[model samples]
Target: MLSRLRDRPWTTALLIACVAQLLFLWGLGRPGKLSFDEVHYVPAARTLLALAYPANTEHPLVAKAFIAAGIALFGDTPWGWRIFGTLAGTATVLGVFACLQLLFRRTPVSAFGAGLAMLNQTLLIEARTAMLEVYLGAFTTLAIAALLWSMRGRPALRLTLSAVLFGLAVGVKWAAIPYVAGAGLLLIWGKSDQRDYWPGLSLFPALALFGLVSVGTYLATFAPAFFYAQDPLTLSRLIPFQVEMYQRQTQILAPHPYQSSWWSWPLLIRPIWYFYEPDNGVQRGVLLLGNPAIMWGGLVAVAACLWAGWRRRSRALLGVGLLWVGSLAVWAVIPKSLGFYYYYHLSSIWLCLALAAAFHAYAKGRFARANEWFALPVLMLFVYFYPIISAAPLSGPQAFNRWMWLDSWR
Candidate 1:
C-alpha cells in the first residue's frame, strides 16, 4: 500500500486532502445548532429558496444559494446548513493540493503542504460552520490556484477562469475585494511582455479577458435576486441594492464581544467564542484559534523568510512573504469599525503554506524529516483542542482552563 501510494503521490495526496477535509467537516456540526454567522447565512439561504425578497442583501447570493441547494437535498437541519460548507472546505483543501503540486511536483512536499493547510485551528472551526468565510476563502484560494496555473503556461483558459472565480468570490463577500485586487496585481506582475514569455497568449489580451469575465460573472450572480418580484428594484434595478449595500458597509457596527483587530490575529491572543450554551443542559463552547506550534512557528518563519530573502536575494522567499503578509495587510487599512480574527482566515491558509515550505526546507535531515512528521504534531494538537473547538461538552471548567492557555482567550 505504501509503495502504491509512493508510486502515485499526486493522486494519493489529492485523495488524502479531500477525504480528510470531508471527514473533519462531517464529524463536527452534528450537535445540530447554529454558530455565529450561520444564523445570518442559513436563513438567507431559506429566503433565497423561497424566492422571497433577499434577506441578507449586504452580501451576494451565490454562497447562500449553495447552502439552499444543500438544504433542498437534505432538509432544513444543521447538517443541511453545513453540507455546502463541508463541500467548500473540501474544495479549499484540494485547491491547496493542486497549488502545491503545480509549484513542486515532489509528492511528499505537495502532500505535506496540503495537510498543513487543513491543520489550522481557525480553519478547522470555520470549515464546519455554515458561513460566508469558507466560501470566500475557498473561491479566493482557488482563484489564486488558477492564477498560478496560468503563469505556468497554458494561460488563456486558466486566466479566464481565474477572473470568473474572483468575481464569484467578491459576489459572496465584499471582503474579497482586496483579494481580487491582490490576485490581479500578482497576475500582472508575473505576466511577461516578451512574445515568447507565455506562448500563444498576450499579457494585455489576457488582462482584458480577466476584466470582462470578472464583471460578467459578478453581475450574473445577482440574477436570481434581480428577478425576484419583491426586491422593489426587481428585474433591471441592481443599482439600488448596490447603493444600499455600499451605504450599509459604511455604517459602523455596534460593539461585539468577539471582535478583534487585524494585528491580534497573527498572535493568536484573542479567539472568538462562537457559542456558550451551558444553560441549555448540554454544556459546550466553540472557540476559534490557530494551532500554537504552527502559528507561532510560522510567524518566526515569516521573519526567517524576510532574512532569507534579504541574505540570499531570493525572489521566491520575498514573494511568499508578500503573500501571507499582504493578505492580512488589507484588513489593517480597511475602514471598518469592527473586525474579527476570523477575517484573518483567508491569509492564515497562505501562512500555513509558507509554514509548509519551511517544513519542506527542513525535511532533508534523517532524524528531522519535516515532511513525514510535521503533520503529526499539527494533527495531535488539533485532537487535543478538538473539545473546545468543536463545542463538545467539557467534563468540567478545569478541562476548559487547560485549553485556554492565554488570558485573552477567555
Candidate 2:
C-alpha cells in the first residue's frame, strides 16, 4: 500500500479527486427530496419525458431534454436525472486535457495544467449535479479546444466541428453567448488577411449545418405536440412555445435568498450551498464552495497574464486571455437577478486557464522559481478547508469560523 501510494503521479491525484467526487455524488443519490433549483429542472425533465412541457416553457429544452433522456433510462433517481451531467462533467475534463495539449503542444506544463483542472472542486461539483452548468462548461471547453487546434494548423473539418460545438454551447445556455462570440471573432481575425481563407461561403456552410442541427433538436423537443394533433403541421405550435421561453428568461428576476452580485464572486465572498442538512450529522451531506486557493490565486495570475500579453503579444496567449476576460465581461454587464456562484462555473474555466498560463511561464523560467513554493501554501489551504467546504464534520461555530471572508455569503 505504501509503495502503491508513492508510485502515484499527478494523473493519479486527479483520478483520486474524481473518485471522491463520485462517492460524494453517490451519497447524494435519492437523498429523499430535491434541493432548490433541482425542483424546477428535475420536474421539467420529467415533464419533457412525459411529453408535457407547457406551451410556454420558460427555458430552452435542450438541457431539460437531456435530463428527460436520463430519466427515461434510470427512472428518476438522483443518479438517474444526474447521470447525463456526470458524463458531461467527465467530458469537460477530457476537453480541458485536449485544450491544454493543443495550447502548449507536447509539454509537461500542459499535462500539469490539465491535471490541476481535473482536481478542481468547482468542476467536480458541477459535474456530479443535475445542472445545466456542466453541459455549458463541457461544450464551451470543447469549442475553445477546437478553436485552438484550428489555429495551430491548416483548417479543415475540425475547424467546422469547432463552430458546431460553439453553436451547441449556446444552444445549451444563452450564457455561452460571450465565449461563442469570442471564438467567432477570433476565427474572423485569424482569417482576415489570408486571401485563400475563404471567409465567405465556406464559413456560412458550416454555420448552416449548425443551424440545421439546432432546428432539428428544437423540433424534436416538442415531439409530444404531434401525438394528439388533428393536423400534421401541429409541430409549428413550437414557435409560440419558443417565444414564451424567451419571454420568461427576459423577465426572470425573482427574489432568491442566496443571490449575490457578479462582483462578489471573484473574491469567494458568496457561495451557494447546493445541498445541506444539519440533521444528517455531516457524514452524508454536501456543501459547495469555490476553491479559495484556485480562485484567489487566479486574480494574481490574471494580472500576470496581462503583463505577459503586453510584453510578448503572443496571439495564442492573447486569445486565451481575451477569451477569459470577454466571458467574464458578459457576467459583469448582465441585468439578471440572483446571479449565484454556480454562474461562475463558465468563468472559472478561464480562471484555470489563467493559472495555467502563469504556471507555464514559471516552468519556462520567465520568472524565478523560488515562488513556486507558493503552490504548497495554496494546496494546504484547500486541504485545511475541505471539511467545511464538503460539510464533512464541524460544530456550528467551526462552520461559522470558516466563513471568514464573507461579503454576501449570508
The top-ranked prediction according to lDDT is 1
Q: Each candidate's lDDT (Cα)?
A: 0.76, 0.64
Q: How close is candidate 2 to the true structure, as a TM-score?
A: 0.81
> How do the residues 1-410 of candidate 1 rate in per-residue lDDT, one tens digit apiece?
76687669667766876666666665565456787888898899998988888688777888898889989998998778877787777777777777766665556666666677777777767777888888898898888788878877778888888999999998888888887777666656666434343467666786688888987888789888755658534544676778788777768889998888899888997888887666246678788888886787788667766666677766556666677888888888877888898888887887766766665554465746755565678889988988888777777555668877889998
TM-score of each: 0.92, 0.81
Off by over 4 Å in 2: 1-32, 152-156, 193-240, 278-285, 364-378, 388-407
lDDT of 2: 0.64
Candidate 1 — which pairs collide? none
Q: Which stretches of candidate 1 lie over 4 Å from their true place?
A: 1-7, 193-197, 232-236, 278-281, 309-315, 362-368, 371-373, 396-399
Find the 10 residues in a row with the least total lDDT in model 2. Answer: 224-233
Report lDDT (Cα) of residue 112, candidate 1.
68
